[model samples]
Target: MAALPTVQAPGIVNLSYAFTNEGNLLYREDSLNYQKEVFAYDELNRLTGWDIYDDSSIPNEEHSIV
Candidate 1:
């Protein structure tokens, strides 16, 4: 099985990520640090969008897609 990728949310709430813009992350956030949203991926396991949520088990503003 493939190992899980690391997720991160390193910034203040309602504020943009210190490193990059949020739009590039493919989801609008009410709070980048606190908002509950999940990463949406394609069948090939590539990120295609986001599942905006009021609650989620995930947190992160950006992803390092390689």
Candidate 2:
């Protein structure tokens, strides 16, 4: 995988990643580091929404299908 440009919005940091061979974006991670909210996408390249994780990487809350 390759790291792409990182776009910073109002309250979120958008990180894009692409495949090494196909150059297709495998997924993206959107996060508010302050809030510990992270959103993960799938191969379809859509926003599968977020899961709240603490510093320990434990899932606290999740939002999907949005």
Candidate 3:
């Protein structure tokens, strides 16, 4: 799990990550705030859904890929 830079609001530190070999982003965290998100993908490398976790590390919301 490597951290990738995020281009969100200016001066806002955000961190995204992906699998080393698959290059699939599995999770993202806001370095300047409390936002933890997870991304899911199908076998074909297509996005399936996404899960949002609160600061407590509990899933709070989810949305399917369109």
Candidate 4:
């Protein structure tokens, strides 16, 4: 797969990645270098849950997407 593109960073990711083994996205960091979001997948390599940075400003609080 192609590498994640570098954007002008519209309050979003400047750098990001996907795990090669499962091809699952790991995380995305903003230009400020703070982890903006994170991800997790199931045994079937399907996306299970993720964390969102809200007004609380917390990081990686487990929450299911489905």
Candidate 5:
């Protein structure tokens, strides 16, 4: 299957993403918001947790899945 390009909302010109060899999303960055989202996977490549950072004002914002 062909990989799809990442899409963002209108007027959001600064956006990027990173993926693993298995096509797993590793991280996403949005320069307009000064934020970055990171993903984590387990041995089986299953989503384990994730973290988000907002450098605009707050130090960091994190979220996890169990």
Candidate 6:
């Protein structure tokens, strides 16, 4: 019998999520790509804005929802 080579599986995703006490998504991050997403809500728990950060880039992208 011959030994075979071992290979790592592809398409593996390393994601993390966070939520508020009210069960609203607050943050999400991808550890593999060093990307992060932050969410903001208003007093009524409505989405107001969000920001996405890429560690590979100099400027972070931010978006405001109306």
Best by TM-score: 6
The 0-to-1 C-alpha lDDT of every candidate, in the order given, reads 0.44, 0.55, 0.75, 0.64, 0.79, 0.75
Kindly list the per-residue Cα lDDT of model 3 for residues 1-66, writing each as its tens digit. Answer: 455556567675666555525778778887667778888888888889989887876789989987
Candidates 3 and 5 compared by TM-score, better number: 5
Clashes of each: 0, 0, 0, 0, 0, 0
Off by over 4 Å in 3: 1-11
Q: Whole-model lDDT, candidate 5? A: 0.79
Q: Estimate each model's TM-score.
A: 0.28, 0.38, 0.68, 0.56, 0.73, 0.75
Candidate 1 structure quality by residue, lDDT tens digits, 1-66: 232233445563353322112223334445644464445555565667655454465444444344
lDDT of 6 by residue, 1-66 (tens): 222222233457677777787767788877777788889999999999988988754439988999
The true-versus-predicted C-alpha distance at residue 27 of model 6, in Å, is: 0.3
Candidate 4 at residue 8, lDDT?
Answer: 55
lDDT of 6 at 56: 54
Sorted by TM-score, highest first, which candidate order results?
6, 5, 3, 4, 2, 1
Number of the candidate with higher lDDT, 2 or 5: 5
C-alpha RMSD between model 6 and the true structure: 11.2
What tens-digit string does per-residue lDDT give for candidate 4 at 1-66?
Answer: 566644555665466455546667776555556555678887888888888653346755668867
Pairs of residues at least 3 apart in sequence or in different chains that clash in candidate 4:
none
True-structure lDDT of candidate 3: 0.75
Ten-residue segment with the worst summed lDDT in candidate 5? 1-10
Question: What would you estimate as the lDDT of candidate 1?
Answer: 0.44
In candidate 3, clashing pairs total: 0
